[model samples]
Target: MNPTRHAVSLGLRRGWTEFVLSLRSPQDQGFYLFMGVGTLAYLWFNRDTELEGTGLLLPTFALPSILGALIAFGVVIGPAYALAMEREDGTLLRHKALPHGMQGYVTGQLLYHSLGLLPLLLVILVPSFLLFDDVMSNGAAGWATVAWVLVLGLLATLPLGMIIGSVVPSVQKVGTWGMLPIITLSAISGIFFPIQAMWGWLQAVAQVFPIYWIGLGMRSAFLPDAAVTVELGDSWRTGTTVLVLAAWAVFGMLVTPRVLRRMARRQSGSQVQQAKEAALQWVR
Candidate 1:
């Protein structure tokens, strides 16, 4: 096998192990659950406005999209930060020096987080059904939308998380800064209100990233055809979003090796020590 493929396979196996760890990992899981709940509650409170008087309709559309955005980012960001910290600590160097080390390192994170959001999605989904059973059942299309968003959200967030984590200083900053894009993008993506309210120039900025398109994809999935609001108008919005995200994924794949190489080449012993001490204090 090619060294890259071999490394990815090993990383995937290790990442799978870590995925199980994430299941048992409290802080990581909490990171996801907290936002999932917060999003659900926030949307529930404003259900009427977003839903336009359809209270029961909120969960079907709202919960999954929010949870997908929240949890998917959570899943990727934490592990990436952890990996970076390890890199800072010189563990990544040790691993990287190993045959296929870099590949394994990245693959472990990707695979571990891939299906990691499933349980959390279920957690968000079931209660949503309990509370908004009528609305959810009413729109079969909505359910389909929810499922699709969750899937695409996974695809979008996982690689993006890898990109973010590759350079982030530590896990602490990951929580602080990493979550910002997802949250900010969610707003831009039309999750909070409508991105349509913004000027075209700003709207153009929002769409520069995948958040708006992903949110639009989610919007299409969850709301009925009539209730659905696709603020950013692209005739082939879904296909476009998929293409954009896939392009990013490819970009991430291509750039990650170079980024890793650059990060490795630039890192020195003292800086790493200083980084670890700072990380420990911050974590504590």
Candidate 2:
């Protein structure tokens, strides 16, 4: 087998192993439970409320949007924290010492993060379907739309996470640089409510980012065609959604490799030691 291909194969296995381990970890299990319960509770509490014009209940309106937000949140922050922590813990350094190591490392991250979404989505979606009515409109066609939106959203946003991880100084900084911004974006991305209610300028700003588009695509997938009246200009804007997400995907493909290479070039034993010391202090 080719060296690069061999490395990528190993990385794929590594990702699968990590996912299995995460499933067995009590902390991860608790996290899944907590998020699923919390989201379901919110939707349940507001289940009877109807949107002013859409005639859809709160859960039906919010479920797909929340799923989209979760997708963006998980893909972006997962790799950011992982890369930062791995960089400090000597994982990246170890890989750097091997030939074609970066290729393998990137592959592992992509696979791991992609697989990571499965449990997250399942934890929320399976129960959601049971508890909510009319949560999926258009049946199989809606599911097909969901599949494409997820694929495009992942392609557009995963690279941004990798870039953030490569650039941040330490794992500690991920909260400020990664978590904060993502949370803010989620709030403004129409996950909790319709973006139509926001100020015009805020809506414009939200449109510039992938989070809003992802949520929009997801809403289009789950909501009935009549619900489009609640969206901006009473249309789904499907063309714009595809165009914007594709642009981000192209940009990430162009930029992430160069950023990773630059970050790898700077890794040194001394920095890893300092990171270890800092981590120890944090633990204490």
Best by lDDT: 2
Q: How would you encode candidate 1's per-residue C-alpha lDDT over 9-96 as one tens digit per residue?
A: 8888887787787778888678668855875687567655445543435555555456545555565665567666776788777775
For model 1, name the residue pairs that clash: 11-108, 15-108, 145-221
**After superposition on all CA atoms, how large is the RMSD of candidate 1?**
3.6
**Candidate RMSDs in order:** 3.6, 1.0
Q: Lowest-scoring 10 consecutive residues by lDDT in candidate 2?
A: 10-19
lDDT of 1 at 90: 85
Query: Model 1: runs farther than 4 Å from truth?
Result: 1-6, 47-50, 53-61, 134-155, 169-177, 233-236, 267-271, 280-284
TM-score of 2: 0.97
Local accuracy of candidate 2 as per-residue lDDT tens digits, 1-284: 79989999988888888888989999988988888898899999999999887789999999999999989999999999999999998999999999888898899899889888888899899999999899999889899999999999999999999999999999989999999999998998888989988999989889999999999999999999999988888888999999999999999999999999999999989999999999899899
- Model 1 compared with the native: what TM-score? 0.79
Query: How do the predictions measure up, each by TM-score?
Result: 0.79, 0.97
Off by over 4 Å in 2: none
List clash counts for every candidate, in order: 3, 0
lDDT of 2: 0.92
